[model samples]
Target: MTDLFSSVALPGGFEEVEHTADWAYHIWAPDYVHLFLQAARGLYALLGAEWSPEPGTTRRVKLQGVDYESLLIAWLNELLFYRYGENLGFNQIDITHLAPTCLEATLGGSPITQWSKDIKAATYHNLAITPTDDGVEATIVLDV
Candidate 1:
Protein backbone atom coordinates (compact mmCIF):
# COMPACT_ATOMS: atom_id res chain seq x y z
CA MET A 1 0.00 0.00 0.00
CA THR A 2 1.23 3.47 -0.93
CA ASP A 3 1.42 6.19 1.71
CA LEU A 4 2.13 9.92 1.74
CA PHE A 5 5.62 9.05 2.81
CA SER A 6 6.09 6.17 0.39
CA SER A 7 8.15 8.29 -2.00
CA VAL A 8 9.75 10.62 0.49
CA ALA A 9 13.38 11.69 0.07
CA LEU A 10 16.50 11.31 2.12
CA PRO A 11 16.57 12.65 5.72
CA GLY A 12 13.04 11.36 5.98
CA GLY A 13 10.02 12.07 8.12
CA PHE A 14 6.67 10.62 9.15
CA GLU A 15 3.04 10.97 8.18
CA GLU A 16 -0.28 9.92 9.66
CA VAL A 17 -2.25 7.34 7.73
CA GLU A 18 -5.92 6.43 7.61
CA HIS A 19 -6.89 3.52 9.80
CA THR A 20 -10.18 2.06 10.92
CA ALA A 21 -9.35 2.06 14.60
CA ASP A 22 -5.87 2.57 16.03
CA TRP A 23 -3.40 5.25 14.91
CA ALA A 24 -0.80 4.45 12.31
CA TYR A 25 2.32 6.33 11.21
CA HIS A 26 4.67 5.93 8.26
CA ILE A 27 8.22 7.09 9.00
CA TRP A 28 11.54 7.09 7.18
CA ALA A 29 15.07 8.45 7.52
CA PRO A 30 18.42 8.46 5.78
CA ASP A 31 19.86 5.94 8.22
CA TYR A 32 19.09 3.75 11.19
CA VAL A 33 19.84 6.44 13.78
CA HIS A 34 17.69 8.97 12.01
CA LEU A 35 15.00 6.37 11.49
CA PHE A 36 14.78 5.75 15.22
CA LEU A 37 14.75 9.46 16.00
CA GLN A 38 12.07 10.16 13.43
CA ALA A 39 9.92 7.37 14.82
CA ALA A 40 10.13 8.85 18.29
CA ARG A 41 9.21 12.29 17.02
CA GLY A 42 6.33 10.85 15.03
CA LEU A 43 5.00 9.08 18.08
CA TYR A 44 5.27 12.29 20.07
CA ALA A 45 3.48 14.19 17.37
CA LEU A 46 0.71 11.62 17.53
CA LEU A 47 0.38 12.34 21.22
CA GLY A 48 0.03 16.09 20.62
CA ALA A 49 2.81 16.57 23.10
CA GLU A 50 3.67 20.05 24.34
CA TRP A 51 7.14 20.76 25.58
CA SER A 52 8.97 23.21 27.78
CA PRO A 53 11.48 25.67 26.45
CA GLU A 54 14.23 24.45 28.74
CA PRO A 55 15.74 21.25 27.44
CA GLY A 56 15.72 18.28 29.73
CA THR A 57 18.91 16.83 31.08
CA THR A 58 20.70 14.44 28.82
CA ARG A 59 20.04 10.83 29.69
CA ARG A 60 21.60 7.62 28.43
CA VAL A 61 19.33 4.89 27.16
CA LYS A 62 20.57 1.39 26.48
CA LEU A 63 18.13 -1.12 25.05
CA GLN A 64 18.48 -4.68 23.82
CA GLY A 65 15.96 -6.54 21.71
CA VAL A 66 15.87 -9.69 19.63
CA ASP A 67 15.94 -7.84 16.27
CA TYR A 68 15.57 -4.51 14.55
CA GLU A 69 11.79 -4.64 14.71
CA SER A 70 11.83 -5.57 18.36
CA LEU A 71 14.43 -2.90 19.01
CA LEU A 72 12.28 -0.31 17.31
CA ILE A 73 9.23 -1.29 19.28
CA ALA A 74 11.17 -1.31 22.52
CA TRP A 75 12.78 2.03 21.83
CA LEU A 76 9.46 3.67 21.09
CA ASN A 77 7.77 2.02 24.05
CA GLU A 78 10.57 3.21 26.29
CA LEU A 79 9.92 6.78 25.19
CA LEU A 80 6.22 6.33 25.77
CA PHE A 81 6.89 4.99 29.21
CA TYR A 82 8.96 8.05 29.99
CA ARG A 83 6.04 10.24 29.06
CA TYR A 84 3.59 8.18 31.06
CA GLY A 85 5.86 7.41 33.97
CA GLU A 86 8.14 10.46 34.15
CA ASN A 87 6.25 13.13 32.20
CA LEU A 88 9.13 13.76 29.78
CA GLY A 89 8.96 15.12 26.26
CA PHE A 90 12.12 14.20 24.38
CA ASN A 91 13.86 16.14 21.65
CA GLN A 92 17.38 16.36 20.22
CA ILE A 93 17.94 12.62 20.35
CA ASP A 94 21.27 11.12 19.32
CA ILE A 95 21.56 7.41 18.75
CA THR A 96 25.13 6.16 18.95
CA HIS A 97 24.34 2.74 17.62
CA LEU A 98 21.23 0.92 16.47
CA ALA A 99 22.42 -2.55 15.74
CA PRO A 100 20.12 -5.42 14.81
CA THR A 101 19.33 -6.22 18.44
CA CYS A 102 20.41 -3.25 20.52
CA LEU A 103 20.56 0.55 20.65
CA GLU A 104 22.30 3.17 22.72
CA ALA A 105 21.13 6.76 22.70
CA THR A 106 21.57 10.10 24.41
CA LEU A 107 18.41 12.18 24.40
CA GLY A 108 17.66 15.76 25.36
CA GLY A 109 14.28 17.24 26.22
CA SER A 110 12.12 18.57 29.00
CA PRO A 111 9.31 17.47 31.26
CA ILE A 112 5.78 17.73 29.97
CA THR A 113 2.96 19.31 31.89
CA GLN A 114 0.19 18.39 29.46
CA TRP A 115 -0.46 16.40 26.33
CA SER A 116 -3.58 15.92 24.27
CA LYS A 117 -3.21 12.19 23.71
CA ASP A 118 -1.45 9.10 25.02
CA ILE A 119 -0.70 5.65 23.60
CA LYS A 120 -1.20 2.30 25.25
CA ALA A 121 1.84 0.67 23.64
CA ALA A 122 4.11 0.41 20.63
CA THR A 123 2.68 -2.50 18.66
CA TYR A 124 4.22 -4.96 16.23
CA HIS A 125 1.32 -5.01 13.81
CA ASN A 126 2.65 -4.89 10.26
CA LEU A 127 5.91 -3.40 11.50
CA ALA A 128 8.66 -3.57 8.95
CA ILE A 129 11.84 -1.55 8.39
CA THR A 130 13.33 -1.70 4.94
CA PRO A 131 16.12 -0.05 3.00
CA THR A 132 15.29 2.51 0.35
CA ASP A 133 17.28 4.65 -2.03
CA ASP A 134 17.44 7.42 0.53
CA GLY A 135 17.51 5.26 3.64
CA VAL A 136 15.31 3.09 5.86
CA GLU A 137 11.57 3.27 6.34
CA ALA A 138 8.97 1.72 8.62
CA THR A 139 5.35 1.88 9.65
CA ILE A 140 4.34 1.84 13.28
CA VAL A 141 0.89 1.05 14.60
CA LEU A 142 0.13 2.33 18.07
CA ASP A 143 -2.65 1.41 20.48
CA VAL A 144 -4.32 4.67 21.39
Candidate 2:
Protein backbone atom coordinates (compact mmCIF):
# COMPACT_ATOMS: atom_id res chain seq x y z
CA MET A 1 0.00 0.00 0.00
CA THR A 2 1.03 3.62 -0.42
CA ASP A 3 2.80 5.42 2.38
CA LEU A 4 -0.03 7.10 4.29
CA PHE A 5 1.91 9.95 5.75
CA SER A 6 4.20 10.63 2.84
CA SER A 7 2.78 14.01 1.87
CA VAL A 8 2.95 15.50 5.31
CA ALA A 9 6.25 16.80 6.58
CA LEU A 10 6.64 15.70 10.16
CA PRO A 11 9.39 15.42 12.66
CA GLY A 12 10.43 11.89 13.70
CA GLY A 13 9.08 8.55 12.48
CA PHE A 14 8.74 4.85 13.28
CA GLU A 15 10.74 1.75 12.47
CA GLU A 16 10.07 -1.94 13.00
CA VAL A 17 12.09 -3.60 15.70
CA GLU A 18 13.20 -7.19 16.07
CA HIS A 19 10.96 -9.26 18.32
CA THR A 20 11.21 -12.97 19.10
CA ALA A 21 7.43 -13.20 18.83
CA ASP A 22 4.73 -10.68 18.03
CA TRP A 23 5.59 -7.25 16.53
CA ALA A 24 7.30 -4.14 17.77
CA TYR A 25 8.12 -0.60 16.54
CA HIS A 26 10.16 2.31 17.76
CA ILE A 27 8.24 5.57 17.21
CA TRP A 28 9.31 9.14 17.81
CA ALA A 29 7.97 12.62 17.16
CA PRO A 30 8.46 16.21 18.21
CA ASP A 31 5.52 16.15 20.60
CA TYR A 32 2.60 14.10 21.84
CA VAL A 33 0.31 14.92 18.92
CA HIS A 34 2.85 14.01 16.29
CA LEU A 35 3.92 11.02 18.34
CA PHE A 36 0.37 9.72 18.36
CA LEU A 37 0.06 10.26 14.63
CA GLN A 38 3.25 8.37 13.98
CA ALA A 39 2.03 5.52 16.16
CA ALA A 40 -1.22 5.25 14.18
CA ARG A 41 0.64 5.30 10.89
CA GLY A 42 3.02 2.66 12.17
CA LEU A 43 0.17 0.42 13.27
CA TYR A 44 -1.51 0.70 9.89
CA ALA A 45 1.77 -0.10 8.16
CA LEU A 46 2.27 -3.15 10.35
CA LEU A 47 -1.18 -4.45 9.44
CA GLY A 48 -0.42 -4.01 5.74
CA ALA A 49 -3.75 -2.23 5.61
CA GLU A 50 -5.28 -1.03 2.39
CA TRP A 51 -8.34 1.10 1.76
CA SER A 52 -11.13 0.85 -0.75
CA PRO A 53 -11.65 3.33 -3.62
CA GLU A 54 -14.96 4.53 -2.23
CA PRO A 55 -15.25 7.89 -0.51
CA GLY A 56 -13.53 7.94 2.83
CA THR A 57 -15.46 7.69 6.11
CA THR A 58 -14.81 9.94 9.07
CA ARG A 59 -15.26 9.33 12.77
CA ARG A 60 -14.49 11.08 16.02
CA VAL A 61 -12.58 9.36 18.81
CA LYS A 62 -12.21 10.23 22.46
CA LEU A 63 -10.06 8.38 24.98
CA GLN A 64 -8.57 8.70 28.43
CA GLY A 65 -5.85 6.96 30.41
CA VAL A 66 -3.93 7.29 33.65
CA ASP A 67 -0.63 7.87 31.83
CA TYR A 68 1.02 8.20 28.43
CA GLU A 69 1.56 4.50 27.91
CA SER A 70 -2.05 3.56 28.65
CA LEU A 71 -3.33 6.40 26.54
CA LEU A 72 -1.12 5.33 23.65
CA ILE A 73 -2.27 1.73 23.90
CA ALA A 74 -5.89 2.82 24.07
CA TRP A 75 -5.40 4.91 20.95
CA LEU A 76 -3.82 2.08 18.98
CA ASN A 77 -6.36 -0.50 20.19
CA GLU A 78 -9.16 1.82 19.17
CA LEU A 79 -7.76 1.88 15.67
CA LEU A 80 -7.44 -1.88 15.75
CA PHE A 81 -11.10 -2.13 16.68
CA TYR A 82 -12.02 -0.15 13.60
CA ARG A 83 -9.76 -2.30 11.49
CA TYR A 84 -10.99 -5.69 12.70
CA GLY A 85 -14.50 -5.11 14.01
CA GLU A 86 -15.61 -2.41 11.61
CA ASN A 87 -13.55 -3.45 8.60
CA LEU A 88 -12.06 0.02 8.29
CA GLY A 89 -8.56 1.45 7.91
CA PHE A 90 -7.69 5.05 8.48
CA ASN A 91 -4.99 7.03 6.63
CA GLN A 92 -5.91 10.45 7.88
CA ILE A 93 -6.03 11.35 11.55
CA ASP A 94 -6.35 14.75 13.19
CA ILE A 95 -5.90 14.88 16.92
CA THR A 96 -7.92 17.92 18.02
CA HIS A 97 -7.28 17.69 21.72
CA LEU A 98 -4.59 16.00 23.79
CA ALA A 99 -3.52 16.07 27.39
CA PRO A 100 -1.56 13.96 29.79
CA THR A 101 -4.47 11.53 30.17
CA CYS A 102 -7.04 12.36 27.47
CA LEU A 103 -7.19 12.60 23.69
CA GLU A 104 -9.75 13.45 21.03
CA ALA A 105 -9.26 13.02 17.32
CA THR A 106 -10.96 12.78 13.95
CA LEU A 107 -10.16 9.79 11.80
CA GLY A 108 -10.70 9.47 8.06
CA GLY A 109 -10.46 6.42 5.87
CA SER A 110 -12.41 3.90 3.82
CA PRO A 111 -13.45 0.29 4.14
CA ILE A 112 -10.49 -2.05 4.40
CA THR A 113 -9.78 -3.94 1.22
CA GLN A 114 -6.62 -5.74 2.32
CA TRP A 115 -4.82 -6.76 5.47
CA SER A 116 -1.92 -9.18 5.40
CA LYS A 117 -1.36 -9.49 9.13
CA ASP A 118 -3.61 -10.05 12.11
CA ILE A 119 -2.86 -7.94 15.14
CA LYS A 120 -4.78 -8.93 18.22
CA ALA A 121 -4.02 -5.86 20.31
CA ALA A 122 -1.38 -3.35 21.37
CA THR A 123 0.56 -4.61 24.37
CA TYR A 124 2.24 -2.98 27.34
CA HIS A 125 5.28 -5.25 27.42
CA ASN A 126 8.24 -2.90 27.90
CA LEU A 127 6.06 0.03 26.81
CA ALA A 128 7.24 3.44 27.80
CA ILE A 129 6.97 6.90 26.20
CA THR A 130 10.08 8.88 26.97
CA PRO A 131 11.37 12.36 26.29
CA THR A 132 14.08 12.68 23.71
CA ASP A 133 16.38 15.44 22.55
CA ASP A 134 14.00 16.17 19.70
CA GLY A 135 10.70 15.31 21.44
CA VAL A 136 9.37 11.94 22.62
CA GLU A 137 9.87 8.30 21.72
CA ALA A 138 8.49 4.87 22.57
CA THR A 139 8.82 1.24 21.68
CA ILE A 140 5.43 -0.40 21.14
CA VAL A 141 4.85 -4.13 21.32
CA LEU A 142 1.80 -5.71 19.74
CA ASP A 143 0.04 -8.95 20.54
CA VAL A 144 -0.31 -11.10 17.48
Candidate 3:
Protein backbone atom coordinates (compact mmCIF):
# COMPACT_ATOMS: atom_id res chain seq x y z
CA MET A 1 0.00 0.00 0.00
CA THR A 2 2.39 2.62 -1.14
CA ASP A 3 1.50 6.04 -2.52
CA LEU A 4 1.75 6.07 -6.28
CA PHE A 5 3.20 9.57 -6.22
CA SER A 6 6.11 8.64 -3.98
CA SER A 7 9.50 9.66 -5.32
CA VAL A 8 10.69 7.15 -7.93
CA ALA A 9 13.43 6.67 -10.53
CA LEU A 10 12.61 7.26 -14.17
CA PRO A 11 13.99 5.44 -17.18
CA GLY A 12 17.67 5.58 -18.19
CA GLY A 13 18.39 5.39 -14.47
CA PHE A 14 17.34 8.96 -13.72
CA GLU A 15 18.43 10.16 -10.33
CA GLU A 16 15.05 10.88 -8.72
CA VAL A 17 11.99 13.09 -9.15
CA GLU A 18 9.11 14.55 -7.21
CA HIS A 19 6.17 12.83 -8.89
CA THR A 20 3.72 15.62 -8.20
CA ALA A 21 1.75 17.85 -10.60
CA ASP A 22 -0.70 20.71 -10.56
CA TRP A 23 -4.30 20.54 -11.76
CA ALA A 24 -3.28 22.08 -15.07
CA TYR A 25 -0.24 20.98 -17.13
CA HIS A 26 2.05 22.54 -19.73
CA ILE A 27 4.06 21.24 -22.64
CA TRP A 28 7.22 19.45 -21.56
CA ALA A 29 10.37 18.48 -23.45
CA PRO A 30 10.40 15.59 -25.91
CA ASP A 31 12.93 13.34 -24.13
CA TYR A 32 10.68 13.35 -21.07
CA VAL A 33 8.28 10.84 -22.60
CA HIS A 34 10.34 7.77 -21.80
CA LEU A 35 11.04 9.08 -18.35
CA PHE A 36 7.35 9.58 -17.80
CA LEU A 37 6.68 6.06 -19.02
CA GLN A 38 9.15 4.65 -16.53
CA ALA A 39 7.52 6.61 -13.73
CA ALA A 40 4.09 5.43 -14.84
CA ARG A 41 5.34 1.86 -14.82
CA GLY A 42 6.66 2.32 -11.31
CA LEU A 43 3.30 3.67 -10.21
CA TYR A 44 1.46 0.78 -11.82
CA ALA A 45 3.84 -1.82 -10.37
CA LEU A 46 3.85 -0.26 -6.93
CA LEU A 47 0.08 -0.41 -7.04
CA GLY A 48 0.40 -4.15 -7.79
CA ALA A 49 -0.30 -4.80 -11.47
CA GLU A 50 1.15 -6.67 -14.46
CA TRP A 51 2.90 -5.30 -17.54
CA SER A 52 1.83 -7.66 -20.31
CA PRO A 53 -1.21 -8.92 -22.19
CA GLU A 54 -3.95 -11.09 -20.79
CA PRO A 55 -4.57 -14.81 -21.33
CA GLY A 56 -7.58 -14.57 -23.71
CA THR A 57 -9.45 -11.49 -24.93
CA THR A 58 -10.08 -9.29 -27.93
CA ARG A 59 -9.55 -5.75 -26.80
CA ARG A 60 -6.84 -3.27 -27.68
CA VAL A 61 -5.75 -0.09 -25.93
CA LYS A 62 -4.68 2.94 -27.92
CA LEU A 63 -2.65 5.91 -26.76
CA GLN A 64 -2.31 9.12 -28.73
CA GLY A 65 0.56 11.42 -27.84
CA VAL A 66 -0.64 15.01 -28.03
CA ASP A 67 0.55 18.29 -26.58
CA TYR A 68 0.38 17.98 -22.81
CA GLU A 69 -1.24 14.74 -23.76
CA SER A 70 2.01 12.81 -23.35
CA LEU A 71 1.77 13.16 -19.59
CA LEU A 72 -1.73 11.74 -19.47
CA ILE A 73 -1.12 9.30 -22.31
CA ALA A 74 2.04 7.97 -20.75
CA TRP A 75 0.15 7.27 -17.55
CA LEU A 76 -2.88 5.78 -19.29
CA ASN A 77 -0.76 3.66 -21.60
CA GLU A 78 1.02 2.17 -18.63
CA LEU A 79 -2.37 1.50 -17.09
CA LEU A 80 -3.43 -0.08 -20.34
CA PHE A 81 -0.32 -2.23 -20.22
CA TYR A 82 -1.50 -3.47 -16.84
CA ARG A 83 -5.12 -3.84 -17.82
CA TYR A 84 -4.67 -5.50 -21.18
CA GLY A 85 -1.36 -7.15 -20.58
CA GLU A 86 -1.49 -8.15 -16.91
CA ASN A 87 -5.22 -7.91 -16.25
CA LEU A 88 -4.57 -5.30 -13.58
CA GLY A 89 -5.83 -1.72 -13.26
CA PHE A 90 -5.56 1.29 -10.99
CA ASN A 91 -7.97 3.87 -9.60
CA GLN A 92 -6.17 7.18 -9.43
CA ILE A 93 -3.26 9.10 -10.96
CA ASP A 94 -1.38 12.16 -9.73
CA ILE A 95 1.08 13.99 -12.00
CA THR A 96 3.36 16.94 -11.38
CA HIS A 97 6.13 19.09 -12.75
CA LEU A 98 8.42 19.69 -9.86
CA ALA A 99 11.53 21.34 -11.27
CA PRO A 100 11.30 23.82 -14.12
CA THR A 101 13.30 21.20 -16.00
CA CYS A 102 11.42 18.20 -14.63
CA LEU A 103 8.20 16.46 -15.61
CA GLU A 104 7.08 13.81 -13.15
CA ALA A 105 3.81 11.84 -12.99
CA THR A 106 2.02 9.40 -10.70
CA LEU A 107 -0.75 7.02 -11.74
CA GLY A 108 -2.87 4.25 -10.19
CA GLY A 109 -4.94 1.55 -11.89
CA SER A 110 -7.15 -1.26 -10.65
CA PRO A 111 -6.28 -4.92 -11.15
CA ILE A 112 -8.72 -7.07 -13.01
CA THR A 113 -8.74 -10.63 -14.35
CA GLN A 114 -9.77 -9.84 -17.89
CA TRP A 115 -8.57 -7.94 -21.01
CA SER A 116 -7.41 -8.57 -24.61
CA LYS A 117 -4.99 -6.96 -27.02
CA ASP A 118 -2.06 -7.60 -29.40
CA ILE A 119 -0.49 -4.23 -28.75
CA LYS A 120 3.17 -4.68 -27.97
CA ALA A 121 3.69 -1.08 -26.91
CA ALA A 122 2.64 2.56 -27.24
CA THR A 123 3.14 4.43 -30.49
CA TYR A 124 4.09 8.03 -31.27
CA HIS A 125 1.83 8.66 -34.21
CA ASN A 126 0.87 12.17 -35.30
CA LEU A 127 2.83 13.44 -32.34
CA ALA A 128 3.27 17.15 -31.89
CA ILE A 129 4.54 19.46 -29.15
CA THR A 130 3.03 22.74 -28.05
CA PRO A 131 3.43 25.39 -25.40
CA THR A 132 1.46 25.43 -22.19
CA ASP A 133 1.00 27.52 -19.05
CA ASP A 134 3.64 25.75 -16.90
CA GLY A 135 6.20 25.01 -19.58
CA VAL A 136 6.18 23.10 -22.85
CA GLU A 137 3.74 20.25 -23.47
CA ALA A 138 3.18 17.97 -26.40
CA THR A 139 0.53 15.78 -27.93
CA ILE A 140 1.29 12.09 -28.40
CA VAL A 141 -1.29 9.84 -29.98
CA LEU A 142 -0.45 6.24 -29.13
CA ASP A 143 -1.69 2.97 -30.60
CA VAL A 144 -2.16 0.18 -28.14
Which of 1 and 2 is the better model by lDDT? 2
By TM-score, the better pick of 1 and 2 is 2
Prediction-by-prediction clash tally: 1, 0, 29
Q: Which candidate has the top score in lDDT?
A: 2
Worst window of 10 by summed lDDT in candidate 2: 1-10
Tell me how candidate 3 scores on lDDT: 0.41
RMSD of each: 5.6, 2.4, 12.5
Q: TM-score of each candidate?
A: 0.88, 0.95, 0.34
Off by over 4 Å in 2: 1-4
Over 1-144, each residue of candidate 3 has an lDDT whose tens digit, in order, gives: 223334662323212222232111122433455435433444344334433333322323333443444545554555556656556554344444433333344544444543333334444554444444533444333332
| Selected candidate, larger TM-score, 1 vs 3 | 1
lDDT of each: 0.82, 0.89, 0.41
List runs of model 3 lying over 4 Å from the truth: 1-77, 84-86, 98-101, 131-141
